[model samples]
Target: MGTDKRHYKEPKTLPDKRNKRPPKRFRRWRLISSSKAVGRFPVLVETIFVEAIIPDLVITQISNGFLHGKIPAAHLPIVDRPHLLDTVVLCIAENPRFTAPITNVTAAVGREAILTCLVEDLGNFKVAWLRVDTQTILTIHNHVITKNHRIGVTHSEHKTWFLHIREIKATDKGWYMCQINTDPMKSQVGYLDVVVPPDILDYATSADIVTREGSNVNLHCKANGFPMPSITWKRETGEMIKLPNGREVANVEGNFLNLTRVSRQQMGPYLCIASNGVPPSVSKRIMLVIHFPPMVWIKNQLVGAYEGQQVTLECHLEAFPKSINYWINERGEMISQSNGRYEPLQKSHNYKTYMKLKIEHVSQSDYGKYKCIAKNALGETDGTIQLFAIPKPSKLLNGIDNDLQDQAGSLLQDKNYVNTASAASRKFICTNFLLVLSALHRLQ
Candidate 1:
């Protein structure tokens, strides 16, 4: 196409951009002009080109923003283009970045716990700690935001943010988030696990138990703590334990202890131990008291001896609350241990008692029915024994030529009692008794 220069019109004046009206969104939020002062020279504000107008872009207080970029190659040829009066130059600070990741924390009750959030280039941004479960803000920058006194905040090098919790409790266990305030908010979360030791529940556990002997008994114990505590049972006196099935065990390993055919031997303090592999394992002590009536049985109910010989009468007594045991003569008078000639001996072990009365000279008065009595808090019991005289023998009385042996020998019988003597001692008793039975004589 050939160019025709005929009737060409030249514009007299260009449209003035100064009279143009501003956009409606710029009326509420606008930027002012300024010149950036370099170290030695000044950067002209007119050189700033708007790369983009971001809608509703906010950085801290900057609600409306304009992205500044280098001038395009096509814009250099336009000499009379519109001038940009929006001169607010922004050198935006860096957004907070987590330099160190949040590590999972495990804390004990009543101990101090710390949560750290290390940020590298946190220029004007802030670091805040918020509870993930409760959504409660704990700390903001170097200042604590929550109402809790146990929560605290600290910072170092204006980057590392630390949330220090003092005297941590079990309720503080959960996820905690570390947040940074930037154009688009950033956050990281870490878990807090709180551990506690075992604690015994006194109101639920058994106390001093008082029951009758030969009755079945059950002991109960309970406890509460973190990680679900485990309970065990043990006898305080370290005696063999009698289980519910009539079996003996060294220790019981559960919260409940069953004792079958209970007796005074199983009566004492019982220990209830609770643990969960945590610190401060705890134990509770309970007392088991048994009650029963007094019981008495004679070892030797029949006795025969020579006139100048010594004789001993024995009785076995068993009772709870320790039975008071004594020996009584045929006249119904209790024998006195203070008398040297008529000695009464007593030996005790737990609920068992042994009572014996020994007379130095077996006179006619000592050869009668003797009684042993026992009394306690429950009731009383007694047993009787008989003393007999024999006639003198002629030949079989350990040598008839011996005059004293012919008229003084007699036979003694232990009334339905088991003899726990040695073989030699039993042989000696048999020889003397058989030889002396032939020389017995009754004396009125």
Candidate 2:
């Protein structure tokens, strides 16, 4: 009766004054055991239980069984599952990439050259400019400008993209591409050369150039410019001339001017200036004149005969500018000249020009025709020679050998048979009969 005397009584719950703590109860079972001893043979004994505590509790018991989500049979070993987004996508696929190629380009036909392209990660780019054989679309995306009226794109307030070629022809020479899409490719290529300048076509002067009278004049100015044309010689009171001493004044290599030997106080009026640097410079003007003529005269009379007999001639003149004299008419007309004889020979030098008329011992009256007179101060001329006064041939062969013996004694009458030689011989009996027939024909 005492064992049945169990009193069970206890029921008191009150403490909910808006609660303060106590509210964590989730338990269904708990039991865990494990032991191992090899040398002593405690083979196996393992058990583990702790209900409902798995939020990933050993991966929810390895996803509840049959190696469900795998790994957890309990030899205790399993870990490996943290793929931070595939290791950041394989470290960005083993990084190393960049692209941009093309540089330094220039052009000049009508003139204007400036085309540059260079880029490297120009962040979020679309930048474009093309003409690569008229793809024509130049520049887009970054502020849209695609009207190639000779192209013009300049931005450097940190935007960088300059390609200005306003006026460049020859069909705008080729290849000008600058694109940037950037992924595995970005590009640049510039090459344009168009330069043309040189054209000048004609200029001239020269034909019988003569300048004398104090002497100094050279007028020759030619032109045709392209890369050549530069000649200057001036004097119209703008003086500049001293070219001559081996002369070679250049503007194309020595365009002559040697006013050194020219006086009349150096006459003026001359200009020859040609410029090829292009810009109006061309000139020509010439005027120079001077004259000369005066100095000549000679004439001194003289004539005589006999003494080997032969002489004749005359000459007379004064000075004013008309003269040219010379005559060795056998030497004898004293005025002044030497070496062809004419002594005391007056007049030394002043351009006596030269003159002649002389005769003093050229018997036979100095044989005819003699005269060469030339006068000046403007006028007078004459020339002639004629003189014959023979009588010297060994006294005319001794008077013709006494008139040929008085005409052979007036036509002989044998006049003693011309001195008797014949008459006396015929008497020699025909001279012994011709010397006895020439001695019998010389004894046959």
Give the candidate number with the greatest lDDT.
1
lDDT of 2 at 5: 14
Cα lDDT, model 1, residue 95: 34
Q: Which candidate number has the best TM-score?
A: 1
Expressed as tens digits, the lDDT of each residue in 21-75 for candidate 1 is: 5443333222222233111222122122223323223322222343344322222
Number of clashing residue pairs in every model?
11, 31
Model 1 spans > 4 angstroms off: 1-65, 68-92, 145-147, 154-160, 297-314, 337-347, 356-369, 384-424, 427-431, 439-444
Tens-digit per-residue lDDT, 1-444, candidate 2: 011113222224323323122122212112122221111211122122222221222321222221122222232321122221111000001111223345555443566766766454353445677778867767664443666566776655324566778787667777887776644545667777554332322345433343544565555656654446667666666544445563433322335454556643345456666665545666666555433333222222212223443232433443333355544332444234452422222233332333333334444434544444554544556544444342333432342335433432332323122113344544442343334334434545
Q: Give the TM-scores of the predictions, in the order they appear.
A: 0.66, 0.21
The window of 10 residues in a row where model 2 has the poorest summed lDDT is 85-94
Lowest summed lDDT window (length 10), candidate 1: 37-46
Total clashes, candidate 2? 31
